[model samples]
Target: MSELVIKDLQVSVDTEDGPKEILKGVTLTIASGETHAIMGPNGSGKSTLAYSIAGHPKYTITGGSVTLDGEDVLSMSVDERARAGLFLAMQYPVEVPGVSVANFLRTAKTAIDGEAPKLRTWVKDVNGALDRLNLDSTFSQRSVNEGFSGGEKKRHEIAQLELLDPKVAILDETDSGLDIDALKVVSEGVNRFRGQEGKGVLLITHYTRILRYIEPDRVHVFVDGRVAESGGPELADELEANGYDRFLKAQV
Candidate 1:
């Protein structure tokens, strides 16, 4: 089975004050087919952990190792990480003014697969994925995320997730701006991806609402750049009933 392992990972970012550490010895492991929910308050280094693993140039790896099925993920470039079957659905998806959504997805697929998908089959698959997300065919012809409403952009991310079929998907605040209906749609897309064999998911969010739909195998409570606690799905309920206050107080 495939696995993503992070061992004592430490990351830092540049600021006017010089390099300040963000992720403090964060470590976690995700096995194939296991959905891990990372719940944390803002500024707790959740996004830093996500971007660090994805090879964002802004984050510096001060220490630690990240491996995917024994391959060193920290050493790979951003595009190289994608080709290695890692997908990150960003919280703020940037727009590419000239590239149509269809072309963007196709290009990503071709890169990951190492060959172009047959045109006829590719077209059907794209349309089908879009339809499943309730996106219109005209969506495929539009530039990537250009002028899209918040919900539309998030839906487009799921559409890419379905079509690309990555080994491990790291979603950063996917439910941030989604309504109930859009949340269900996005959750359904994630569930569909989880249904695939040996696929792992790292879902990050502040609210527990998405947990109602995508049942995580493990729930990790992140506090102060580290995983303060971890348990089964019930932990999310506990968090909802109480809040991060207890955890934060303990940390202090």
Candidate 2:
């Protein structure tokens, strides 16, 4: 089974003033068939951890290690990390101005698989993924995330998660900007991916609402760049009831 291990990880970002540390000795492990939820207040470095593991150049790893199934993930390039089966769904998905969604998905699939999928089967697969996400087949012709609503963008990301079939998915605040309906739709798509054998999910969110649909095997409370505490599904319920005030005080 695949496992994503993070050991004492430290990360920094280059701000105009100087380098600012975001993730401080953050460590956690996500194994196959497990879903982990990271819950924290804003500016707690939740997204930083996701981007760092996904090889974003904006964040620099100052210490510790990140490994995927015993391979050095910290050493891989951005695309290399994706091909290595690590996927990051950003809090804010960026726009690809001129590229059609169809072409982008196919190109990414080809890159990850090392060969293009046959046109006939690929077409059917793409359409099926889109339909499952409640997206119209015509959506394939539009520019990726360009002019699409926020819900559409998130749905598209899940569609990618399904077709690309990565070993692990790191989703940063995917529940944000989604209404009740959109949230359920997106959560369902993620649940479907988690159903696959040996798949792992690292869902970073500020709210516990989405957890109702996709229950986490573990819930981590992130505070001031570190995981303040971790527990089972009940920990999420605790966060929902008690909020992060206790964790914030402990950090102080």
Candidate 3:
């Protein structure tokens, strides 16, 4: 089993003026097989936290530490952290103009497992995952996310998730740009990761729609770069009902 621990984490982004703090002494934990949702308004640093955990070079970890299954993740390079069992599905998945999906998946799969998946087996696995996402097999022949619709891009991210199968998956706004059907497809893909042995999920979103399908084990309300409230699934319902007003007021 694996665990992701964020202890006293403070993050800052570099600006011409200086380092601007985003996350303020935030700490959280996610154990294997558990799902945690991070909800917040825009500019609340929700995305910053996700990028920091994934070791994005643009963000500076001004303070604190991030550890994965007892290993110091902050000290590891981005590729090393992924090999160490961490995955981040970005809010805006990039377009690799010339890379075919099959080729990209194979390369990522090999990098993660340190062995190439057999050609026949890999094709079958990729096909099965595409079917689950309702993506056409023809997509595998096309360049990654090039000319893909918003919903298609999101589904493509889920496709990568199915292929990578990391120990922990941080989905930064996976619910964004997805229609109802696409949202359910993405949610189901995330659901498949739950297991008795363990796989952790950090779902960052602004809406409660995806939570209705995935049902996080815990919900955290982030306000002004820190967690303002933490609770169970019902917290999502409350956020949907009352919105982030109380959270914004509390931040003051």
lDDT of candidate 1 over 29-63, digit per residue (tens): 99989999999999999999999999999999999
Higher-TM-score candidate among 1 and 3? 1
Each model's TM-score? 0.99, 0.99, 0.98
lDDT tens per residue, model 3, 1-252 = 889999989999999998899999899999778899999999999999999998899999888989999999999999999999999998888889999998999999999999999889889999999999999899899998899899888888888888889899999999998889999998999888765258899999999999989989999999988999999999999999999999898767
> Which residue pairs show collisions in model 2?
none
Better of 2 and 3 by TM-score: 2
Q: Taking the candidates one at a time, how many backbone clashes does each contain?
A: 0, 0, 1
C-alpha-based local distance difference test score of model 3: 0.91
Work out how many backbone clashes candidate 1 has: 0
Error of 2 at 188 (Å): 0.8
Which stretches in model 2 have alpha-carbon errors above 4 Å? none
Off by over 4 Å in 1: none
Task: Name the better of 1 and 3 by lDDT.
Answer: 1
Per-residue lDDT tens digits for candidate 2, residues 35-107, read 9999999999999999999988999899999999999999999999999999998888999999999999999
Candidate 1 least-lDDT 10 residues: 1-10
